[model samples]
Target: MPEPELRTDRLLLRRWRESDLEPWAAMNADPEVREHLGEPLTREQSDAVAALMRAEFEERGFGWWALEVRATGEFIGRAGLDEVDAGMPFAGVDVGWRLTRSAWGHGYATEAALSCLAFGFEVLGLPEIIATTTVGNVRSQAVMRRIGMTRDPADDFEDPSVPEGPLRRCVLYRIRRDAPPAARRAAGS
Candidate 1:
């Protein structure tokens, strides 16, 4: 399936293209941007990731959409819904993002995420959506809350991929499709 394009007030979320290689590599190379995700991905690794995302779009009907500014056509970041991996605490739609440092402080993350969550629930007919992050990743967790996901402290667990370390423990947050309409509206549908 071709990856469908998604639009927000000021952003355009589309599939990756060859032109995005340079900036995408620069973004992944930033230590601060990769803090929660561990080490920076090398140029080769970044290229491989781009290829994988492209393949996922062709196979899964959806994956991480490349986020760009509608006005400037700049690749600000990414936000989209994907099926949760088996190891994740919850098995359902997963919403996430990674914006450039310059895009920080703006509400781009929340805005793009709200659209993806709505698409997952209302368009894809998903019953729920889940998001997870390292315990100290307050920024992402805040976005999850901003999108109406309630923290499931009971489901929090150590990420096996993180090894036995400070960042290993992670929290899971979830929002059911049948949640109150008011809360959904509060999440900015």
Candidate 2:
């Protein structure tokens, strides 16, 4: 079967396009947008990543999808499920998302992520899905909770790859397939 595209009420999670490279590069170049993600990325780096994301889905049937506003076809960013990096201690599929500053505070991340979880569990037949981010990323943590993923302090750890800094201290959150849908979208995005 082909790599599948996912949709939320307002977002379309699909493969990347050449047209997205420019906006993707611009979004990555924004310091505010890259604040929690370390440093900004160059156009070439952005393009390379988009290429890799596209290739991964084609190769594995599941990978990052370029997130777009269904009404406008705007390439806001990316959201999907992928295996945790090899450097991490735990092993399993993980859900993640990155959106342009304009897209933040719009609940697009939570919508797309919830869609990803449904896909991981219902379609991919995954037993569980996890999400991790630096402890400082309360926005993302809120989204995780809003989507019903719970965090255990014990699951938090220092990222082996990141240098000694805030980004190094990461926290993990997870939701099992059998867990009840505990969706609780708090106010204020």
Candidate 3:
């Protein structure tokens, strides 16, 4: 059987498909979405990243998911858990998401994030998962907190990938395996 699809009340988190390329590319092209991620990606760059995610699913058993709205079956964005890049401060699982501006304020990012965290902590049996964002990305930080992750002010550091400047400063958050039930709760997530 194909790998199982994770469902939240209004969305599906599943493997990417060829049909997702256009929307995925569009999302990467948005200036607002790319604000924290660097400049907008060219179509080639976006496809290459999608190809890498496919490879990750095959090799790592899990990777970023193609997020679709259940009500409309429309491509919305992506969210999931994965290992931090080698240069990142944390060495283990990290949960994250990205959505188009049209999909903002609808809770889709939070919903998808909670589902991804559930998979990492409960399904993958990970001990902990960490997340980092540019210190000023208040929207993302809010989602991290809503999901019950705690800020480790000490873990904050300059992101190695970002050139030394304002954007390099990042804040880190984490939720442990032993986190309280409410903190790890994904049922209403």
Compared with the true structure, all predictions reach lDDT values of: 0.85, 0.87, 0.87
Over the stretch 1-189, how does candidate 2's per-residue lDDT look in tens digits? 477898778999987888989999999999988877888999999888888888888988998998999999999999999988897889899999999999999999988998888888888888888999999999999999888889999999998988888889999998888775343222111
Report the C-alpha lDDT of model 3 over 1-189, residue by residue, as the tens digit: 255589989999998989999999999999999888888999999999999988887788888889999999999888887788897766888889999889999999989988888787678888888888999899999999988899978899988999987789999998887888788674232
TM-score winner, 1 or 2 = 1
Residue 73, model 1: Cα distance from true site in angstroms: 0.6
Comparing 1 with 3 on TM-score, the higher-scoring candidate is 1
Clashes of each: 0, 0, 0
Q: Following a full C-alpha superposition, what root-mean-square deviation does model 1 have from the true structure?
A: 1.2
- Which 10 residues in a row give candidate 2 its minimum summed lDDT? 180-189
Residue-level lDDT tens digits of model 1 in 48-146: 988887887789887789999899999977788877777754577788999889999889999899888877877788888889889999999999888
Candidate 3, position 18, lDDT = 93
Candidate 3 Cα misplacement greater than 4 A, ranges: 186-189
Model 1 scores a TM of 0.95
Which portions of model 2 show Cα errors greater than 4 Å? 181-189
Candidate 2's error at 104, in angstroms? 0.9
Look at candidate 3 and tell me the lDDT of residue 14: 91
Indicate the residue-level lDDT of 66 in model 3: 93
